[model samples]
Target: MLATRLTALLGIRHPIVQGGMSWASSNAELALAVSEAGGLGVIAAGPMYPDDLRAAIARVRAGTRQPFAVNVPLYNKRAAEFLDIVLETGVPVIIASQGGPKAHIGRFKEAGVTWIQVTANPLHARKAEDAGVDAVIAVGGEAGGHPGPDEVGTLVLVRATVNAVTVPVIGAGGIADGAGIAAMLALGASGAQLGTRFLLTPESGLHAAYKDLVLNAGIGDTAIVGRGRSPIRMVKNAFSAEYEAAANRGADDAELDALFARSSLRQAAKDGDVAQGKVEAGQSAGLIDKLEPAGELVERLAREAEAALSGAASCIR
Candidate 1:
């Protein structure tokens, strides 16, 4: 009964959407479980080849009949290929991030797919609406992976984007609980998308050590590095320290690329290389303390958000 514009448009019961993490979202179990729990689960199609993406989509479809989405980082070299595979596989929704959706939005609309664009600012939000996107996910600097250069907070970004676009807005970054979802809704967001919160779920494919790091981290433990290149929020470690130091000393883009190229995100997410590889997470890591099933977490989030909203409404009465 926690229906919103997002839930109505996506045909889901709850307005919660799990983020598309690179290595973590490659598998279908988490996505399937979340979708079955009445929230939209997104499979990250960035780190996968065409064949792998197709297989992942098939696995989720076979596991659950509920609606799910495929997130394609528009900047990825194989993004178009992944989109083709998703369309061919008959996926119902598409979430595009990290680049402009103008070129691909038309194709997704033509395929009768629900196209959602991820934006870091109002400018991008307006652009997405102009491109015919059904919705826009406003991501703030508190987000994991590559955040936008504006470095705006989620609360303010959500409201600004909502005013700039006619499409439904989903707030993302630093949101880990029912309180956060309620706050976003109050800010005019129709839904909330959480990457860091979902990363620690039991169904997530992330390594136990990485999850432990996330669980142990505090609110300010995350640091944004490589501003000139791609601003990324991750748990502080020896690897990040070195990377940050290099960037601070005026490292060129090539140098930054070389530094980052030394290790892959999968190395940390799958193999648990806490010291060397990057553990991309958001400021929301501070809110996660335990691991639970994706389905249970989804249900809990919905119930908690409902109760919180009801309590707030009772204050006026």
Candidate 2:
């Protein structure tokens, strides 16, 4: 296996990280499995109450002694409370995303929790470093769920952010297999964070229908909706089509919010309501054809990345 700054910094055996996909990642089973497999498993702390967050943390701790993280999307109104939960529970790592981390970085640092901020562009990376974040996760537009308005892909965004910031940059978006991991490292990312791939893992608590949609879908199957706000990448279902059409026709913020409330990601991931619920998935969904155990997938990715790196190095000789 290959080691990088990310593995050393996060105290994980591999440089792979399972993204904290809200609703889908609320269950600690997948996180625990990934951590046990030597990769960092981050629990989704977004859209959860303080008590629920506490319970999720407890579940992870009960499952594994290895290091893990909790992703706090600042867009969540309960973000501050979630941070408090992380601090109170002594979570080893906290990933701040979806908004500025200026307010919470200091507190996280003071509590000795490793703070990794998620950025979608070079400016965000610089700002995160200024906020004193321990690391930066550069999420590109191709990523599933909310990837911000910027349309930069993972390859370009990762390289640019790595050049712009002094902190270690983790590449996200469109990454799935071992080759993708190796490619990102070559572009200067310390590691890769995968959202779609892990969502398809057997340990993930997402519904079977959602996993089937992802497995059968191609790269063109997913589309980005919600133009007025942070666009979310989701499968092209009836709900997505209606939402996109309404947004294109000048739907107000209130209308959009209503639509979101009616067809939230939680419904899609948990209830398997593909026609009405938001099926969030990255373009990497095309790369994955089957659902396997998280531990098996992690080991497979490590082996693939190691072989890919070895092959690339052979060219120099």
Candidate 3:
């Protein structure tokens, strides 16, 4: 089995972790599938109600004896409630994002839960490590959803975070396959987390139209809306085009904010409004052409990563 510090800490056979994409992983199916395949599966608590989150956790527990995580964005209105549920449900791991971990990490540690903080840069990674996080997942600008406002590429950002922190680091953002995961490991990250790759899986909760659009996207097809504000990397569509036009014309923050508020990931993921909604996806969409079962994909990724690492080692001689 391919192993690393992350695999040992999380009790998984492989060091791969599925990114907890909202709407995409709001259900337990995808998380359960990945966990059963010996990867760390994360159920996103971002868009779920308290009861729904509990139910999702229960469903995953009932489906597999393997470990799984719940991603709780600390900036959400119900963040405290979500944390409560995570603690009460006895979840094995907590992948936290969008806020400082100093206040919350203590309790999770006390509960014997693994706390993996999501940081966007070296500074944040250092801060997370100082706050007692067991590990940190460094997200770069190429990631979908909120990929920080700095726009640093995954290679530079992940390597920077690895050098900045003493804890194990999981490199995220723009990773779509085994080669990418191997690259992260080579850069000193213990593992890699993939969002877009898992989002295109058959078990993802996105609308068919949303998946189709992402599946057809190219490497340069994604656009970043909101440069100074909280930014998101999504597939280029009408909504992004409109936003880009407004920004190009020097639209003020208020104007851009209003335009941004008009569309939502829920609109595209839930209603199939691919043309006018936030079809959130990463640059990795260009690398994925087909939808695979989450379980099978996890196994394939592990095998591919092993082969990639072995092949790269041959070059040393």
Better of 2 and 3 by TM-score: 3
Write model 2 residue lDDT over 1-317, tens digit each, in one string. Answer: 77899999988999999999987788788889999899999899876678887888999999899999999988888877888889999999998888898877877788889999999889989988998998999999889998868778988999999999988899999999999999999998899999999999887878898888888989889999776565789988999888878888888899998886778887878888878888999999888888888999899999999999999999995
Candidate lDDT (C-alpha), each = 0.89, 0.89, 0.94
Q: Estimate TM-scores for all models.
A: 0.96, 0.95, 0.99
What is candidate 1's TM-score against the reference? Answer: 0.96
lDDT of 3 by residue, 1-317 (tens): 78899999999999999999999999999999999999999999999999999999999999999999999999999999999999999999999999999988888889999999999889999988888999999998889888977889999999999999989999999999999999999999999999999999999999999999999999999999877887899999999999999999999989999999999999999999999999988999999999999999999999999999999999996
Q: In model 3, which range of ten residues has the least summed lDDT?
A: 224-233
Task: Give one digit per residue, the lDDT tens place, for model 1 in 1-317.
Answer: 78899999999999999999997887788899999999999999888788888888899999888999999988899987888887899999999888888777777788899999999999888988988999999998899887888899998899999999988999999999998999899998999998999998888888998889988999999988767666688899888999989878888889889997886678789889988878899999988889878999999999989988998899995
- Whole-model alpha-carbon lDDT for candidate 2: 0.89
User: What's the lDDT of the predicted structure labeled candidate 3?
Assistant: 0.94
Clashes of each: 0, 0, 0
Off by over 4 Å in 2: 247-261
What local lDDT does model 3 show for residue 259? 96
Predicted structure with the largest lDDT when compared to the true one: 3
Better of 2 and 3 by lDDT: 3
